[model samples]
Target: MKKKVVPYLLVSPYIIHFLIFIAFPVIFSIVLTFHKWNIISPMEYTGFANYIRLFQDTLFLKSIINTLIFLVIHIPLQIIVALFLAEVLNQKIFLRGFFRAAFFLPVVVSGVVVTILWQQLYGFDTGLLNKILVTLGFGKVGWLIDPKIAMPSIAIMATWKNVGLYIVLFLVGLQTVPKHYYEAADLEGATHWQKFFKITLPMINPTIFLVVILSTVGGFSLFIEPYILTGGGPLNSTLSAVLYIYKQAFFYYHMGYSATLGLFFALIILSVVIIQKKFIEREV
Candidate 1:
C-alpha cells in the first residue's frame, strides 16, 4: 500500500499543476464566453449572443477562409518536401547528423524570431530573396507586398521553419521500415519507383498521417508570422483565425466574443482531425 501510494504522490504535483493551470483555465474561459464581463463589475448572461455575433462578423469569416487556404497550401507542401528530404538523408551519406541538425534547427528557434527573419528575407527591395531572383536572371518580384503572393509567401516561410522537424519525423519512420522489404522488392525486379510506392510509402503512411495532422493544426493557428510580417495586410490576404481572435479579445476588448471564436476554432480543429484519423485508419 505504501509503495502504490508513493508512486501516486510522486505524480500528484503534475496532476495538480495541470488541473490548476491548464484544465481550469480552459473550463473557466468557456464559461466566460457565454457571459459579458469586463473583468470588473457585474457579469451579465448573454447566452448565445457571442456565438451569434461571430457568424455575422465578415472579418472573422475571412479569417476562417484565409486559415483554411493557408492549411491547404502549407501542410501538403511541408509533408512532401519533408518526405523527399528524409528519403535523401536516409541513404548512406556523409554528414547525416549534421544535415539532420541543420534542417531541424529552425524548429527549435522562437516563432517570433523566425517571422522577423523571414520579414527581412521577403522584403521588396534589397531583400536576399529578391537579390537572388535578380541575380539568377529572373525579375525581382514583390513577395510580401503583393496581395496575391502575401499568403503564399507566409506559407513558404512557415514551411521553411517547420519542414526540418517533419524531415526528422519521416527519417525516424523511414529507419523503422524493414530492409528485407526493399530486398524482396529488388529480387522481384522492382524499379526504384516501384519499390518506393509499393514498399516505402505504404509502410510510412502512419508518419505521413501524423505530419498532416500536426501541420494542419499549426497552419490553422498561425498568427505571429502574419502579425509581424504582413499584419494580415495586403488586403487581409494573410489574416488567420488566431489573429482575428486576438484582435477581437485584446484589441477590441471583446473577451466574450473572442472566447466564442476560440471555442469555434477548437471545434474545427477537433472535427478535422477526427475525420482525418478515420480516413487514415480506413486506409490502413
Candidate 2:
C-alpha cells in the first residue's frame, strides 16, 4: 500500500494541474462553442449557431488568407537566410562567437519592444526607410498604412525577429552531419555547390521540417505586429486569424462565436501540420 500510494503522491501535482488547468479549460471551451454567453450572462445553448456564423464570416476568412500570405513570404525567406547564415557561422571565421550572438540578439529581445521599434522605423512621414528612399530620389513607400504592402512588411519584420532561432537549429543540424561525407565527396572532386545539394541538404531534412512547422505556427499566430503597426490595416489587410479571434472574444464580446472560431482554426492548423508532415516525408 505504501509503494502504490507513494507513486500516486509523486504524480499528484501534475495530475491536479492537468485537470484544473489544461483539461478543464479545453472541455469548457468545447462546451462554450455550442452556447452563447457574454461572460456576465448565463450561457444559452445555441447548438451550432456559432459554428454556422463562423463559416459565414468574411473577415475571418480574409484573416486566414492574410496569415497564409504571411507564411508564404516568411517560411522560404526564413529558411534560406537562416541556412545561409548557419553555413557561414559554422566556418572558422574571425569573431564567430560574437557574430553568432549578435545574430541571435533579436530572438532574445522582447517582441513588443522590437515591434514598437519597427513601428517607428515604418512610420509614414518620419520613418527611416522612407527618409532613405526620399534621399535616394525615390517615393516614400508606406510600410504599414497601405493595404497592398502591409502584410508583406509585417512578414519581413517577423522573419528578422525569428531567423536567429532557426539559424541555431540549422547550425546544430549542420554540425551533426558527419564530416566524412564531405571528405568522401571531395575525394570525388565534387564542387562546393554540388556537395551542398547532394549531401548537406538531405542530411538536414528533419531540421528543415522543424523550421517550416514552427514558421507556419508562428505565422498563424501573428497578432502583435499587425495589431500595433496596422490595427488590422487601412482596409483590413494585415488582420491575422489570431487577432481576428481576439477581436471576437474581447472587442465584440462574441464569446461563443469566438470559441467556435478557435476550434475551427485549431482544426485548420492541425490539418496544415499534418499535410506538411506527409509532404516532407514523401520528399525525404
Candidate 3:
C-alpha cells in the first residue's frame, strides 16, 4: 500500500494539471455548446440552436471548404518533401547537421513571426518573389490578396514551416530500416526507385501514418497564418475552421456558438483520424 501510494503521489501533479487544464475545459466546452453566454452575461440554455446556426452559416461552410483545400494540398506536399529531405540527410554528407538545423529552425520559431515574415515575402508589388519575377520580365502576381491563390499560398507556407518536424520523424523511421534489406535488394539488381518502393516505403509505413494524422490535425487547426497574412482573405478564401471559431468567440462575442463550432470541429478531426487509421492499416 505504501509503495503504490508513493507512486500515485509522485504523479499527482500531472494528474491534477491535466484535470484542471485539459479535462475540465473539454467538459465545460461540451456544456457550453448547449448554452448561450457572453463574457458579461449569465449562461442560458439554448439546446442546439448554436449547432443549427453553424450549419446555416455560409462563412462557416466556406471556412470548412478552405480548411479541406489546405489539407488536400498540404498533407501530400509535406510528406513528400519531408521524406525526400530525410532520405537525403540520412546519407553520409558534409554539413548534415547544419542542413537539419536550417530546415527545423522555422518549427522552433514563433508562428506569428513566421506568418509576418511570409506576409512580406508574399506581397504583390515589392515582395521578394514578385521582385524576382519582375527582374526576369514577368508580371507581378497577387499571392495573399487573390482569392484564387490565397488558400494555396497559405498551404505552401504551412508546408514549408511544418515539413521540418516531419523530416525529423521520417529520419527516425529511416534509421530503423535494416541495412541488410537494402543490401539484399541491391544484390537482386533492384533499381533505387524499386528498392525504395519495396523496402523503404513498407518499412516506414508506420511513420507515414503518423505524419499523415499529425498533418491532418494541424491543417484543420490552422489559424495564425490566415489570421495574420490574409485576415481570412479578400473574399474569405483563406478562412479556416479555427479562425472562424476565434472570430465567433472573441470578435463576435458568440461564446456558445464558438463552443459549438469547436465541438463540431473536434468531431470532424476524430472521424478523419479514425478513417485514416482504418485505411492505412488496410493498406499496410
Candidate 4:
C-alpha cells in the first residue's frame, strides 16, 4: 500500500499540472467554440453557429488561401535550398563549422527582430536591396507594400529565416546514406545526377517527408512576419489564417468565434498532415 501511494505521489505533480494547464485550457476552448463570449459577459450558447459562420467568413477563407499560397512557394523552395546547402556542407569545405553556425544564427534569433530587420530591407525608397537595384539599372520593387507581391515576399523572408534548421536536418539525412552506395554508383559510371536521383533522393525520402510536414505547419503558422511587415496589407494580401484568428480573438474580442476558428484550423492541419503521410508513405 505504501509503495502504491508513493508512486502516485511521485507522479501527482506533473499530473496535476497537466490537468490544470493543458487539459483544462483545451477542454475550455472546445466548450467555448459552442458559445459566444466577449470576456465581459457570460457565455451565450450558440451551438454550431460559430462553426457555420466560420465557413461563410470570406476574409477567413481568404486568409486560408493566402496561407496555402505561402506553402506552395515556401515548401519547394525550402527543400531545394536546404538540400543544396546540406550537400555542399557535407562536402569537405573550408570553415565548415563557421558556415554551419552562420546559417543557423537567424533561426535562433528572435522572430520580432528578424521581421523588423527584413522590414528595413524591404523598404521601397531606401532599402539596401533597392539601393543595389538602382545602381544596377533597375526600378525599386515593393517587397511588402504591393498586394500581389506581399505574400510571396513574406514567404521568401520566412524561407530565409527557417532554412537553416532544415539544412541541419538534411545534413543529418545526407550523412546517413551508406558511403558504399555512392562507391558502387561510381564503379557503375553513374553520373552525379543519376546517383542523386537514384540513390540520394530515395535514401532521403523520409527526411523529405518530415521537412514537407514541418514546412507546411510552419507556413500555416505565419503571423509575425506579415503582422509586422505588412500588417496583413497592402489590401489583405498577407493575412495568414493564424493572424486572422488572432485578430478575431483579441482585436474584435470574439472569444467563442476565435475558439471555433482555432478548432477549425487544427482540423485543417490534421487533414493536411494525414494526406501527406498517406502520399509519402506510398512513395516510400
TM-score list, all predictions: 0.91, 0.94, 0.91, 0.95
Give the candidates in order of lDDT, highest first: 4, 3, 2, 1
Error of 1 at 45 (Å): 2.8
The 0-to-1 C-alpha lDDT of every candidate, in the order given, reads 0.89, 0.92, 0.92, 0.92
Q: Clash number for model 2?
A: 0
Better of 2 and 4 by lDDT: 4
lDDT of 2: 0.92
lDDT of 1 by residue, 85-173 (tens): 99999999999999999999999999999998988998788799999999999998889988888888888899999999999999999
**Model 1 error, position 187 (Å):** 3.3
Worst 10 residues of 1 by lDDT: 35-44
lDDT (0-100) at residue 219 of candidate 1? 80
Candidate 4 colliding pairs: none
Candidate 4, 1-284: lDDT as tens digits: 89779989999999999999999999999999999999999989999999899989999999999999999999999999999899889999999999999999999998899999999998999898889999999999988888999888888888889999999999999999999999999999999889989999999999999999998877878888888888899889999999999999999999999999988898999999899999997998
Q: Where does candidate 4 have its weakest 10-residue lDDT segment?
A: 217-226
The local lDDT score (0 to 100) that residue 95 gets in candidate 1 is 99
lDDT of 2 by residue, 1-284 (tens): 79889989999999999999999988988999999988998999999898888879999999999999999999999999999999889888999889889889999998898899999889889999999999999999889888899999998899899899999999999999999999999999999889889998999999999999888887888888888888898799999999999999999898988988898999999999999989988887
Candidate 3: tens digits of C-alpha lDDT, residues 43-93? 999998988898899888889989999999999999999999998999998
